[model samples]
Target: MAEEELQLEDGSKKKKLFIIIIAVVVLLVGGGAAYYFLMGSDEAVSEEMTEQGADNDSDESLTSTTVKTGTALYVAMPRPFVFNVPGSTRDRIVEIKAQLMIRGSDNEEKAKMHVPLIEGALLRIFSTANADDLATEAGKLAIRESALKEVQIALSEITGQKVVEEVLFTGFVMQ
Candidate 1:
């Protein structure tokens, strides 16, 4: 009789421990779900607010240098610029596909309208670059900066504002 009572008591204790563990797991899962849903809703609300704020803001306040907005516009050249330059051993042909980054749609239109001039200026700059110089990363960067400056100057002369924020070489090949 005593042994039977001991067995019953042990069984009861095991059942109680199982119940406690199950409760803990349930609470943890529920808490995690709550946290996830709450955070997700908050982020959605914040994103909507940001969109509304952007819509409310006007473009007139944007200066030539104030491109602190979240968006950047890219305008690709219609054709690649291909030329030959003097390399260390022989003449190397270089082909470059370039793009311009501008702030607003107006600037983008202006840049598109002046594509011929921009291409001519860039080709003039690229023609002066030696194949040996362009073979290195630093040389490429220098060429890009020089091209950016020239494009900015050209656009500024026409628009009375710097239209292009950056000049990027999207594709480059040398052979």
Candidate 2:
């Protein structure tokens, strides 16, 4: 009777072990299947987005290249322009760092070739600014516009085209 009881206990333990192993195997297979499906869906979505982006790019490239001939470029002045301006209270000293935005490589080369002339033109424009006017944003914009016009005129006379599309003031200081 004792031997039969021992045999029944051993059978129950083996059955429990078998059930645990089967559960673990089922979990691993389910997890692997889930990972495979999720990864495949992400790849398909990315491929679709890439194809749509390519189509948009093709449409834009045609219109953009025709409107603008060359890539935009910036040419910086060798030194900042430092000068004095008269104010209602007293005279103030000003410094301006400038750059030129040109449309194409041809214009860039033309601008580089005539840096001295550009500097002189800008200096003349800056010298006329009033300290009181420089303190205001509108005054600063007016001065910038004047500088652009002056530079364009100067370059146009030499290069037969406005080599500079814009005059950018990168830095400004007052004391």
TM-score of each: 0.63, 0.61
Clashing pairs in 2: none
Tell me the spans in candidate 2 whose CA falls farther than 4 Å from its real position.
1-68
Per-residue lDDT tens digits for candidate 1, residues 40-100, read 9999999998886676455543223435454579999999999999988999999999999
Q: Where does model 1 exceed 4 Å of error?
A: 1-70
Q: Write the per-residue lDDT of candidate 2 for residues 4-108, one digit (tens) a residue.
A: 999999999999999999999999999999999999899999999888766655774311122235788999999999999999999999999999987888788
Scored against the true structure, residue 143 in model 2 reaches a CA lDDT of: 95
lDDT of 2: 0.86
| Residue 36 accuracy (lDDT) in model 1 | 94
lDDT of each: 0.86, 0.86
